[model samples]
Target: MVSLREREAELANETQTLQTAADLFDASVSEAANLGQSSASVLVALQGRVDAAPLATAEASRLNLLQVAAAAQPVSIPTYQRASIDEKDLVDVGKAIDGVRLARESLPPLVTDVRDARSTVTAALTSFRGELSNLGSAIESEAAKAVTINDSASQSFRAAVTDAAARVKAAQQAGGDGLAEMPVYAASLDALRTENARILALEQAERDAAPTTPRNPGSGSNTGGGTNSGGGSNTGGGNQGGSPDTGTNPDPAPSQPAPDPDPEPVPDPTESEEPPIIIDPEPAPSGTVPGATS
Candidate 1:
């Protein structure tokens, strides 16, 4: 009887556990149904919103406006060229950030190329600056060298002229002293002097050897003819009664005077009327003797 009672109690406990499990199951089913209804309502509301909104129409309008602008402007889209960037866009931090982000994303290679070009330009500028600085120094150095060369040339020219003058003076003195071993210039001067002296001596000898003519034998005048047979000689001595010998001397030494002839008997003034004969000697010919005249 004890064993049968223990079995009945275990059966009742098992029935209660089963009833509790069924209640938990029914509550979970109801919660699931409520969740499904709420989800369906949210989905219906979202569908109504989508159906009523003008998003597509507005987007189409925007596209149409863009096309009209493109037709009016006649500009190509997705072009690399830009006319201008707005000041507001550049100054606004948000816009500037967005622009930079877009640029980085879309044109990474262009950005890299711009950076590289800027670096190259900077390097070129630096190199050009250095070259200009070096050019200044080079020009200064070359100018100094030119000055040195000019001074050297001037000094050299002066020295050369001085030496040449000294040599010329020495040559002149050597020639004046009649040195046999003188320079060519000195010898030439000596020869010229000798030739001049020889010419002078020959001229003097010719003048000395020339014959001089006697003047009229009766007149004191040396150039004019006179009726008097006696005239002055070339030496300014008293004239002689005859012509002189043809020699270098125009007049010989004075000799004894000739005796006067006897006077003729006076003719009757009415019977003789002829004039007295006056004898005047002619000028002697060259290299010939002159005859005596009475």
Candidate 2:
């Protein structure tokens, strides 16, 4: 018959093994962080352009993306910094191997803690990688989000352009009342032009990403990618493992129990990490609310 002491020994081993595995998990995360950083760089650049754009454009979808990005803060992924033995709550069954009653009562619980920690680490990696992928895809294809000026929209688009041009003209030939509305009207026209130019730029970028690929001999799409400012989330679990160590045993468990001779008792894990705060690229500073339909 397997002695309770031996079984408890097995549980202790499991705990240490899992803690070691958790330490290595960060290596896997570093690669994901690198990929996310690439996408983040591009996203930031586009955000800057949007910020400088005139508020008259009133692009709500873009603004919403901005808000989301702000909410999904902490885009930077960190590598493993922990080096010390992370067996804080991990029960050292070896210490209690001689205590049959204690081992029976405590060993199983230690295994539970070990398994949970590893699961937490695994889950965090999955979520972190997934978020990066989503954010990248959103940005690389974001140019598609602009309002399309197709046949249905052409009338409104032309009207806006005409109105803006007329306003600029009136402003230039300012008289009494005209002078009062001169600056306002002229500023509005400039905003309209900026919006128009943005539309054109997006179209150009789209064409660049996947240029018309001929079906015959040499084929190429020459595609261009884009970004949505709603920054990617790291709503994943926090980095697992303890502080850095020099291959030494971790400190004894802090919690008291007549169980482990050395290792400490683990408490129920409070798993979730902080939800990141996304940096939003706000609209232009001209205090212009979006009212025009461009």
Candidate 3:
């Protein structure tokens, strides 16, 4: 037969143990719920990736077509020649060819990147599914433990009450007035009721915080930039400047007109009229003297 005080003590201890177990169960449930949510988020991301795969593939195909077009057609030379192209047509052709070659060379890596993205999404989905399954199992097990603890605590509490009641009845029978001692039993009953209420409150809090189904997982953990379907980065090479020779020439500048040559001077007309006049000769002193100097 347990004394009234001893029985009260045992009940208090049992209640404390129950409270501790309930707290641990609550913590476990929270962790499981978080895990479940994370798993769900991973799944959603994975699905998004899977859906995006085709778009990435299409983009890669488009790039391939661009490469082929670049290769087949001359970039600097048009079907019809233009004034701009005429001066440096050969140089323009070389630059255009180089540009097309660079574009074509870049396509292979882009395609590979897209393929890698598809693989990552698939792997993430599989991992998320596994984690969700594990979390579900853990939550179920913790719930079962909580149930068992609750049952055991209830049984212990009831037995403690009965034993305390029996002890109070015996004490009353051995004394003068049972009513006079009733206050003692009532006080014990009140204490027991208070302890039970505290236990109930703790249990309620646990249940309120428990995880439910249809959990929502958040976003992905990766902090990197956006990748194409092949898992390659979207950014490409830097821009090179225009041709230096075309940019620098000073003469015959497109903005200025060409200089005119100097005009020829007019001929004098008076020279033709004055050229016919002649002088008269002196008389011949002698045929020989006429031509001789005196």
Tens-digit per-residue lDDT, 71-152, candidate 3: 3311121121122333246675555445444444544454444344334433433344333333323323333443344442
Residue 26 displacement (Å), model 2: 6.0
Summarize candidate 1's per-residue lDDT along 91-151 as a digit string, tens digits. 4444444444443344444334434433443343333333323322332333334333334
Give the candidate order by descending TM-score. 2, 3, 1
The stretch of ten residues in a row with the least summed lDDT in candidate 3 is 73-82
**Deviation (Å) of 11 in candidate 2:** 5.9
Off by over 4 Å in 3: 1-91, 117-125, 152-294
User: Which residue runs of candidate 1 sit more than 4 Å off their true CA positions?
Assistant: 1-104, 152-294
Residues 203-227, model 2: lDDT tens digits? 7888889744334311222111322
lDDT of each: 0.38, 0.39, 0.40
For every model shown, what is its TM-score relative to the native structure? 0.18, 0.25, 0.22
Which pairs clash (backbone N, Cα, C closer than 3 Å) in model 1?
A: 216-231, 217-230, 217-231, 218-230, 218-231
| Candidate 2 stretches greater than 4 Å from native | 1-12, 20-43, 46-97, 100-107, 118-124, 143-294
By lDDT rank, best first, the candidates go 3, 2, 1
Comparing candidate 1 with candidate 2, which one achieves the higher TM-score? 2
